[model samples]
Target: MTEAEMLMEEKLRKKKEEEEEMWAEYLEQRKKQRAKEEEELRKLKERQAKRKLQRAEQESKMNEYKRKQEEQRIREMEEKKSREAEAKRKRLEEAEKKRQAMQAAKEKREQEPVKPNFVISKREGDEMGSALGSSGLDKFANIMYARGEMGKTKEQMEEDKKAILSFRVKPLEIEGLTVEQLRDMAKKLWEKVVALESDKYDLEERQKRQDYDLKELAERQRQINRSRALKKGLDPEALQGKHPPKIQVSSKYERRLDRRSFEDKRELYDGGLEAMTDAEMEKMWEDKMNSFKEQSRGQLPKWDPENPKNKQVSHIRRLEEEDDDEELVPVFEPPKPEPPKPAAPPPKPAQQQEEEEEEEEEEEEEEEEEEEEEEEEEEEEEEEEEEEEEEEE
Candidate 1:
């Protein structure tokens, strides 16, 4: 042990011895007090007996009985006093024990922490300088404790000391102040508190929002990647704030197959689930062959190049109103023209109608003449038939 440890042990030993001597003195004092109380109690009993004897001889039996009851009450009072003294002694003993415990703890606390040791040369003639020592574990504990202390201005340091010395509890200053003034002060303080609280809340909310935005963007990038791991979280329909993806992210294999089919001008296999339609394959081929393509190499398919039943889920909105953050604008459509009415036929001339009537009369006269000719021919035939019949008979 060093000199400090030896000195500390010697001090603790002396302290313990002094406490033992004090305890012994207290016990002696308690003993003397008990002895004095006993002597007084014996005298009190002797006086009470003497009074009872006097009262019994000079008064009635009833008076003597009352005196006896008074002596009994006095004895009970003495007993109570003795019990109180005993309780007090126990309390003192407990207090002494606590004091001893506290002293022991104080001594333990006095064993100062091992500060960095400063070593000086012990030699009489040596010009060696002193060096600071390093206790490995606690080396950093004392560092930075006085880092900025040396940089403090003298005025500021003196003001700090003055404030420490002047600090004292004082009564509230309300001697001449109106209730209105107090209310106004309270209102101002409350408003200041609310403003501070609001500022703190806003700062916290901004930090939280920033963190959320960063995480969301990273999550979106991850989803857009062709990794199979992130395919499960690519739910575009579940509102993700601001703009959502309009196309589905194709997997690595899907993109590769699409590129292969585009380059080869044919599907990889015939009649399978992974096969693309002729139109879709042709579109992909066109996109691939476009040498001036502005899109990146990590391009997502606008429409599902493979069959509709593929794992790639498309979220392309058919209407502008379907966008998450955009307002729908109205589209203008021209009204259709009505069909034209049919033109009316012109009126016929009067001279053409008169000519038509004259022709009809001529046609009636020709029909009558032909009918008379037919009747004459029928009569002639009948006469010739009768003559032939007579000759035959």
Candidate 2:
């Protein structure tokens, strides 16, 4: 081989080796870059997973907190409702207890018996006993026995004895009572008696007033019946059949009358017949009237000017004064009614357009019918004339 050729070959070989080395280095660099990219991707995924987990935990905690808050609110509301219900129940119980207590007190007061200042004793055992002498002691014992037999309990007897002992006799003085105190006591007692008498008088007056009102009501009913008969064009005498009989009541011997059975008596009273004499009824009526008058006087206004109906009462008084000698004055009549207003005038022609149009149409139709009839008559006449002329020819 030529020396030049061999040198050329060796140089070519060295150049080829250098090219291969450069290729290997480039491949190694590419592999390292790919591995680095994969590691970076793994790190990013881990960080993202951690953030997601943290967000999920936060949401769960918030939900749990909300649930606890809701539970707490519900519990508070339940507690408040229970408290209110308990309070209401207690209030109702208290009210019921008060009512029961009041009823019991009223019943007790009603059941309590009225006691008098003095009592007499009766018994056979004390007949021979001491100081009063045998007959007087026997009489006292008999009285005590009689009292015991007359439905008086032992406690009631003792109370009566105590009251008798405590009572002050005439021309007697109490240790603590001065003249002024005695006078005051007497005045109070007098006033109480006066009040009782006044009450009795008022009751009588009230009864009388009620009787008057009842009579007035009966008269009014009669008048109303008569008026109704007149309106129906029936005979007024027919009202006599409808009239109720007069009722009579007793005033004296009131013990026979049981006020507790007043409702039962009302039915009998409505039958309109006297169960008592006229004198008794009159006495009762007087008592009731006096009682009512007294009550009315007591209830009168302190000052007449303060009354709402004062003006009306004053007007009544003025009317009474105008007729000084008049007794049993009649109640004032209502004012007369005002005259009725005249009816309105008829509507003008402009408002009657529809009616006018109908009338015109009817008239036109009638005229047309008449003209048609006349034409028919004329035709008939012509025909007759033609017939006659033909005959003559």
Task: State which candidate has the highest TM-score.
Answer: 2
Model 1 stretches with alpha carbons more than 4 Å out: 60-393
Q: In model 1, state the lDDT of residue 119.
A: 62
Q: For residues 1-393, what per-residue lDDT tens digits would candidate 2 score against the true structure?
A: 899999999999999999999989988998999999999999999999999999999999999999999999999999998898577556446655665696578669779997783765666666545434447656777688667658878886675555433432234455799889989888987986796698699989999999999999988988998888778656675565756423334453466755645467567656444545666889999999999999889655344353335655888999988887565577787998999999998777875988888999999999999989977876786677557756766
Q: For candidate 1, write residues 41-146 as lDDT tens digits.
A: 9999999999999887877878888999999999999999889857755644665566569657766776867665576456464332322333443445435434
Over 4 Å off, model 2: 1-26, 105-393
lDDT of each: 0.67, 0.74
**In terms of TM-score, how similar is model 2 to the real structure?**
0.23
lDDT of 2 at 94: 64
Lowest lDDT block of 10, candidate 1: 126-135
